[model samples]
Target chain A: MLKAIWDNIKGLYSLLVGLSITGRYLVSPRKTIHYPRQVVDDEILASFRGPLELTRGRKEPGQTRCISCQMCVRACPGHCLTVIKGDAKAPSRWIYDFSLCCLCGACVEACPAGALAFSHKVYLVATSREELKLDLLADLKARTEKEAPPKNE
Target chain B: MDLSLAIFVQIIVAVLLIIGLMVGNAVVMVYMERKVAGFIQRRPGPYEVGPWGTLQAVCDSMKLLAKQVFLPGNVDFILYYLAPILAFLPVLLLFLPVPFGPILTPLHINEGIVLILAFAGLGVLSNLLAGWSSNNKYSLLGAGRAVAQTVAYEIPMILALLAVVLQSGSMDLAKIVGQQGQYPWQWNIALQPLAFFIYLVSLVGETNRAPFDLPEAESELTAGFHTEYSGMGFALFFLSEYANMLLVSFVCASFFLGGYKGPFLDGIWWTFIKAYLIMFFIVWIRWTFPRVRFDQLLNINWKWLLPLGLLNLWLTAVLVKFLV
Candidate 1:
């Protein structure tokens, strides 16, 4: 009986120890970055894989490196890609259904022209299913224009 | 009992003020508990609602007020409706006798401690009523647990307080506070450390705060007794809960920690400081500890706290008889 009482006393002491540990953490700096007010580190954002976009051509930033190979369309497990071959080797339409994307990086690997890469669009929000059907050619053009030098001032 | 016009007016005003105090205490405690929990978990809790989430509790109370009062089918309507009111109103009565300051007590009853202790038990009746009348199996189970736990824990709490009453030689709360010295070492806690520890344990158990929150055990019982309540019905329970915590913390301050009497000052602020410190400790432990099993909770009360409290009471009685 005496030993049991002593054991409980020791158990109560351990409870105090637990309180002290949490007390330290209560005053410690918060780990969260307020999302709207601040974003995470550049390194983490760079490493993040969001939706896929067509890689820019080495010579002309506006031109697509895709050669209508259909390797990416074939490799995509979700069947989210639509590439209609045009007059030349370049594709006329590059439709990417983002809703069906599993973000598995299979399409990025199978591209022979190295024309597909993951974009860092962490705050991507789609209100409806129809809005998720992204026209990658138009997206690439918008991005190219945004990155281009200002027209001769 | 001379019923003077002035005394009657004071009573009415005090009741209204106590209601305001209970609501204000609920708001402050909600902010403190959430902020403390957030800090412990390394996150900024409730930041978007107002400046540093100060008005978060206000917004939440507004939401609860605006919510639909849902009545589940087959409930005993009268008792189901009565439970939340029963839980809340008795607590205001409990606050009356608490020596908030030397001069600040709402009522000056000679048997103040008795009044507080007696009415404190009424909270459990509401829990039982809410549980039984709700017609939900989880609510019934929760109410059953609440009844048993409250009944079991009250013994040790009474014994602990009785030990202090023995030492102070008064059942009157203000008189008890007057007996203690202002400093920490001069408090009743220094004289009867065992009783203080017992009271602290039972205070948590009595308040039904975690890890003693088995009645509202979210994992097992799904909000327990208040499972069927919504809108203002739920809000009343929440208000009474924080009010009850504030009440017991005041009792602890008065009994053990030298209520309204502290180092450097002898004012109402001392009582507020001591009571809020106890509330902070309660919030601290709620985040720190896991809920004990029902059997374990009972065993702690019956085997450990009850026995210790009785021993402490016996020792106090012996010392008071011969030494004092």
Candidate 2:
């Protein structure tokens, strides 16, 4: 009975010790990100796997190196892509649905023309089902015109 | 009629005070838990918002309120809807009998200790209802664990309380506190140290805190009984959890720490400070310890706490007769 009482006192002492240790940190700096209000830094963003984007080359102009070999279509596991061959008058358009794209970068790897590449831009993904579809030809034209590297000797 | 009106007004004020304390403690505890966890992990928790993340809880409550409620088709509509309220109501009711301080005493019931225990037990029933009503197997398992664990721990807890009653010769918390004021060394903790230790362990288990948190084991049970609940329903469960933590800590203070007794102040402020100090300890233990396995949790209660508590009771009885 005496031993049991002693053990109980020991337990209380240990609990008090634990409490003191934690009480010290009650006023310490907290390591929580107030997300949505403050965006994560680029280094942190690079570590996290977010949405993927298509890339453009510095030297190539008015040209996407895509050979239309259908390798990306074959490689796609989600089967979210549709490719229609371009006639002589119409520019080739690849309709890529962001809804179906897993952001796996398989299409970027399979493109032999170097026309397809992943971009660093993230956070454009839409929540609505209809907004996820991307018009590849329109996107490509815009990319070539807007994001093309600056011309210099 | 005039006397009845006075009683009515008193009741309203009491209820409001309990609600205000619950809300304030829940908000403070949420921030404190995060900050403690971050510091323990050697990182800064939330500094960017309103002077060292004090507004984090307010923002979180807003976010939870803004979230859309999602109800699945297969759920039992009424029970599914009622579960969060069931989980919340008992904790609020439990607070009615808790005396914050001698002067700040809100409601004084004759059997206040029993009232506290009764309402505390109701929390387990809420967990059971939440789990079984969700129509999910994991919920069922979680609820089963909750019932079993409550049964095991409550025995030791009650036994510990019985020791306190023996020492103070009263179950009325106000009287118990009054008794402690007679002497400097007469605090129940000093006389009934074993009971205090048992009560502390049982308090942790009773609150379903870490090392005893099988009811809502996220890794295995996926939010446990409240898995299917969302929006306001989820928020209510969250509120009740912190309320229950506050309730246990308050009880601990009342029984052992000389409820509301301070070196100089000797009033409600002392009670509030001691209660929050106990709450800080509870939160600290929660973040520091990894959860115990379901079987081990029950084993600690049944094979250890129950027997030790019984032995403590017998010892207390003999000591009170001879020593006191």
Candidate 3:
């Protein structure tokens, strides 16, 4: 009975300890980043894989490194990719149905020419499935054009 | 035998003001609870609604007001409608006896503590009615738990306050306040610390706050008795719960913490400050502790608090008889 009493007293003391621990945390600084007002650090966002994009060729910024091998099309589990081979090794059309893409990185790994990679488009949003069907070659061209003037300077 | 026109007007005005206090207290408490919970969990809660989310509770109340009053099928319609109203109305009467300041009591009566304690039991009736009338098994279980918890805790609570009543030699709340000194050391808490401790524990149990919130244990009961209530029905329960917390805190402030008496000034502001500080402590602990098991909750009351409260009351009586 005395032991029980002592144990209960210790348990009551433990309650106070719990309160003190939480009380210390209560005045401590909050860890939330407040998303809209501030974005995440680039270091944290660096490894984020959002959607597939065509990497720029080493020789020319606007040119694709893809050689229309159809390897990525075969590698894609979701059958989300379509490549129409042009007269040259370069592809005329590279369509990526993002709605269908599982983001498995299989297509990126399968590319022999090192043409495809994941873009850090964390803010990507779409209202409909059609909006998600991306034209990768056109996206590459727009990106190259946006980068051209800055490089010339 | 005769009630004056001025007295009648004062009572009417006081009732109206008390209603406003209940609604306002509910709004403030919602924001406070969420923010404190957020801070403890290392997040910023409710920052988007207004400046530092000050108006989040207002928006939430508005949403509750606009929501469709969806009643479940085959409910006891009169009792179902009556439960929330019953839960809310008794709380207004409970505030009437609280000595907010030296001269700020709404209705000064002789058996003030008795009035408050008796009416407080009416809240449990509302819970029972809400559960039984709802035709839901979870609601019935919640109501059962509420009845048991409230009934068991009330004994220790009454014993705790009874010790203070003996110490002060009065049941009049203002008289109790008048007896205590205007400082921390001179408060009843210093003299009757065990009773104060018992009162604190029972206060949490009686209010159905966390650690003893078995009635509304979310994971187990899915909001307990008020599960079927939506829109204004749910809102009324929410308001009453906070108002109940405020009432008990006020009781604690007066009986143990020297009511409207503080070091600097003796006024209603002291009462408000003390009461809110107690309320803040309630919110703090709600975030800190997990809910106790239903059996453990009862065990704390019956085995520990009840005996401790009796011992304190007996000691206070013995000391008062011979020493004081």
Candidate 4:
């Protein structure tokens, strides 16, 4: 009975400790990252993996790193990657179904040509399921076209 | 001030002011509760409505008011309608006895503690009606739980108040407030710590707040007794809940924390600061603790609170008799 009373007193002491902790937090600077008004720094977002896109050859301008290899297409467990091998060395049309993509990085790891990489630059926001079916080759061509800079001139 | 007509006009004005304050308190508390909850969870709460979401409560009130008054099939029309009004009305009466500032008390009467306790008890009837009239099993269970919880917690609350009452040798709440000194050491809380402890527990349980919110257990009861109520019906119950928080804080401030009494500048502002501090702690505790089980809730009141209250009362009586 004496021990029980002692334990009860200890409980009261602990309760005060809890109160003190909350009091500290009440005055401490708020840890909230208020979205829309303030965005997270890209330095902190560097490690964030979003969706898969074909990587362009760093050395060779206007050329992709893909050699029309079907390693990624065969290895994708989610069957999200579709590579239509065009006439030799021509820019192939790649259709990526983001709806089925599990984001497991299996396709990226299986790529022998080092053609695929993840980028969070364009965070996917689509209104419809059909919109999630991204025409990657067309997007790659557009990007290359934009980067190619005034061929007609 | 002695003129009868003047007294009547004063009473009317006081009533209108209290009514207006009641609604205004609900809006402020709704906003504050969300902001506090958000801060505790490490997120910004309700920042879009008006600068830092200050007008979020106003927008929410408008939304609730604008919604349809939907009544589910086979509900008792009269009882269903009366429940929210009944829950709200008696609380207004509970505000009367306590002194706000020195000259700021709207209504003053002797036997103030008894009047407040009696009206506070009437809240249970509204819970019963709300539960029964809804024609839902879950609502009935929630009402039953609420009724049981309130009935149990009220004993300790009264005992705590009674302990303070014995120390003061008066039932008048204003007189009780008058007895305490402006300094921290001279307050009734310093005199009777155990009683204050009991009052804090009972206040939380009696108010049906978290850690004891079995009745309104969202996961189990699906909004509990207010499940069937929509539009203004839900709004009234919600308003009362916040108003009840203010009322309980007022009681705590008056009875224990020295109402309207402070160092240097002594006025209504001290009372408000003290009351809001108590409220801030309550909100903090709610976020910190999880809800207790129904059986655990009852066990807490019956096994722990009641006996401890009785012991505290006995000790207070003995101390007051011999020492005072």
Candidate 5:
């Protein structure tokens, strides 16, 4: 009975102490990020795994450095990547099914030419299932077009 | 017709109370957890949105609501669909028996204590159904662990509670509270402190809280039984969890801490304060302790708490018979 009483007293004491600490923190400022609307910027975003991105080499133009070796296709554990080898003249057609892509970056590293790079633009990827299937040729074309320097005078 | 109208009104009031308490506490607790986690980890948390991220829960809810509700192809249609609701319903119903304040007992069944335990135990069923129906091995494992933990902890919890019931000599929680009022140190905690300690520990474990949170162990189970859930399904599970936490705290306050028995102010305010204080401790424990191993969790209850609770009950009975 004495031991029971003692335990209960200690329990009550501990409960009160715990509550006091929590109560103090409750009144204190909160530490949650209101995601989407009041977006957390790059500094905090670095820690979270939101989405994947693709980056290009500074000096390489029209050169993704992806040597159509199909290593990324084989290495891609998710099987989200579809690569159609382009003629030696044409850029290799690499289709990325974002739906299947695990964002593991296996494909990015597998590119021997350093052509395939992860981008930082982690927006809502796609809505429709069909849209998530990215045409490699079209993506490359767009990237080349976007990266191409404005026509010189 | 008049009786039916009264019943309807009572139900509406009860529902409103449950929703109001659950939503309000969830919002506050979510904010509190983030801030507390941040404070413990030596960093500023959520300083940007709506004055220190007060609206963070709102934003998170909106984002989740907007997100696509994915239904995995391999999942069992009915059970998979029903899992979240099953997981959530017990938490909602568990509040029906909880006495929030002195005069503000919303839905008081005669056997409130038993009702609370029964509903609380149902939380495991939902977890199991979710894991099994999802057909995911990890989810199944999580659910299995949850069931085992629930079974292990609930025995000690009930035994501890039985000690309080033995002292009070009634199962009706309101009467138990009334009985406590007759004594000088009214709270059962003063009389049966060991039982109270056992109750607290078992309550935490029963609720799958930290140091005992094996079911949803993030590192191991990867979000546990609700791994396959998305959108509203996930939201329901989230809502139910906070509701469970609140329910546990309410019961703890009622059984041991002298329900609604404060020094000066004697009513609903005291009850709410005590209950919230209990909740704060629950959250504090969550942040403070690392999760206990599965084996350790069972052993703690069976080896230590069960025997101690039984002994405490025996001692309480003898004391009441002789001293009281």
Candidate 6:
């Protein structure tokens, strides 16, 4: 009978302890970041693996680092990467159907030329299948044109 | 005595005001419960709709109102219709006997305790009817559990109340409140802590709320007695549940914390604050603890609450007779 009474007191004590713990948290700073209203910088957001993007050449800004050896196409498990063969100096047509790209980063790892990197575009929602078919060569050209503006002689 | 039209109008106005407060209470309690639960878990809860989601409850009622009333074919038609009405209707009368302020409360009766308890008892019948008429196995089981839980918990709750009644030496709620002073030291809670504790525990069980919320255990029973009710039926049950919450809080305030007596203002605001503090405690405890098992729930009421309540009552009786 004494033991039972002791156990009951212990049970009530534990309930108070639980209440105190939750009570402490009730006054604690709110952890909610207010998702839509406040967003973390895309620099931090971009670090997240959104999709694959060709790394810009260090020597020629906005130009791709790809050497056109077809290493990425061969390495891609999803067979999502399609690279048109070109000379080392010339830009190659790289069609990346993001629809099938599994984001394994195998191509990024396998590229001996260090030509691939994860895209900073995190919001990559696409409605149509065609929208997922990304033309990487056109993207590279647009970047190079924007960065390396022709000298307006 | 001749019936006066002025008195009749006053009663009508009071009744209408009380009904309006039920709607108002639902919105406030729903908002408060969600926000309290959220903060306890370190989340912001609802922050949209209006400033700090103040209008979230308003939006919820609109949504509930928009929903099609889905009554299952298997349900007993008469009982199903009646259950929702009975669930909420008694709560209207329950508020009449409460001492909200020195001059407030819709009706004043000598046997206020009797009126409150009798009406409060009707809630169980509604719960049973809701579960039984639904014709679902889970609903039937929920009703059975609710009946058992209510029956078990009510004895201790009454005994605890009896202790207070004896201490105050009156059943009139206003007189009971008058006995306790303005300060915390003079409160019934200070005087009858054990009874207060018993009442709090029994309050949780009596209301069919969390830890003791076996009847509506969402994980197991899938909305319990009101499982089949949708739209207006669901809304009425929801409203009644919240109105009951306010009712219990008011009783807790009046009985233990000294109703309407405060430092500067000796009026209804004190009652509101004390009542809400109790409500907040109930809300806090709900989020803090998991639902107790059926056996454990009954055991707490029987083995602990009942014995403690009886002891407290007998002790109070002795103290009052000899000392006071």
Docking class of 2: incorrect
lDDT (Cα, tens digit) per residue for candidate 5, span B1-324? 998898779878888778878888888888887877776554566667898789998998898899899988789979988988887776767777666666667666788888888878778888898889988888899999989999888988899988888777888777777666633387888888898889889988888878688988999989888899899989888888888888878888788887777787667776777778787677777876668788878877887899998899899889889987
Clashing pairs in 3: none
What is each candidate's fraction of native interface contacts (fnat)?
0.91, 0.36, 0.79, 0.24, 0.06, 0.97
- For all candidates in order, the CA lDDT equals 0.94, 0.78, 0.94, 0.85, 0.77, 0.89
lDDT head-to-head 4 vs 5, winner: 4
Query: What TM-score fits each model?
Result: 0.91, 0.71, 0.92, 0.90, 0.68, 0.88
DockQ, every prediction: 0.78, 0.22, 0.74, 0.40, 0.08, 0.78
| Collision count for each candidate, in order | 0, 9, 0, 0, 12, 0
Off by over 4 Å in 1: A1-4, A55-71, A74-77, A86-90, A106-115, A125-131, A137-153, B1-7
Better of 1 and 2 by DockQ: 1
Rate residue A134 of model 2 by lDDT.
Answer: 74
Chain A fold similarity by TM-score, each prediction: 0.80, 0.61, 0.80, 0.74, 0.66, 0.73
CAPRI grade of model 5: incorrect
Q: Candidate 1 lDDT, tens digit per residue, A53-147?
A: 98888777788999999999999999999999999999999999999999999999999989999999898899999999999999999988997
Q: Could you give candidate 3's per-residue lDDT for residues A1-153 as a string of tens digits?
A: 999989999998899999999999889999999888889898888899989999988777678899999999999999999999999999999999999989999999999999999998888899999999999999999998888742321
Q: Cα RMSD for candidate 4?
A: 3.7
Model 1 lDDT at residue B169:
89
| Model 3 alpha-carbon miss at residue B264, Å | 1.2
Over A1-153, each residue of candidate 4 has an lDDT whose tens digit, in order, gives 889768866876877877677666665677777666777789977888877777877665456677768888898999988887878853478888998988899888988778888866545689998898988766767777887662321
Give the per-residue lDDT digits (tens) of candidate 6, residues A1-153: 999999889988999999999999999998777767886676678568877888777777566788887888999999998888676654468889998989999999999889898887856788998889888868867766876663321
Full-model lDDT, candidate 6: 0.89
Q: How are the candidates ranked when ordered by TM-score, highest leading?
A: 3, 1, 4, 6, 2, 5
Clashing pairs in 1: none
- What's candidate 1's DockQ score? 0.78
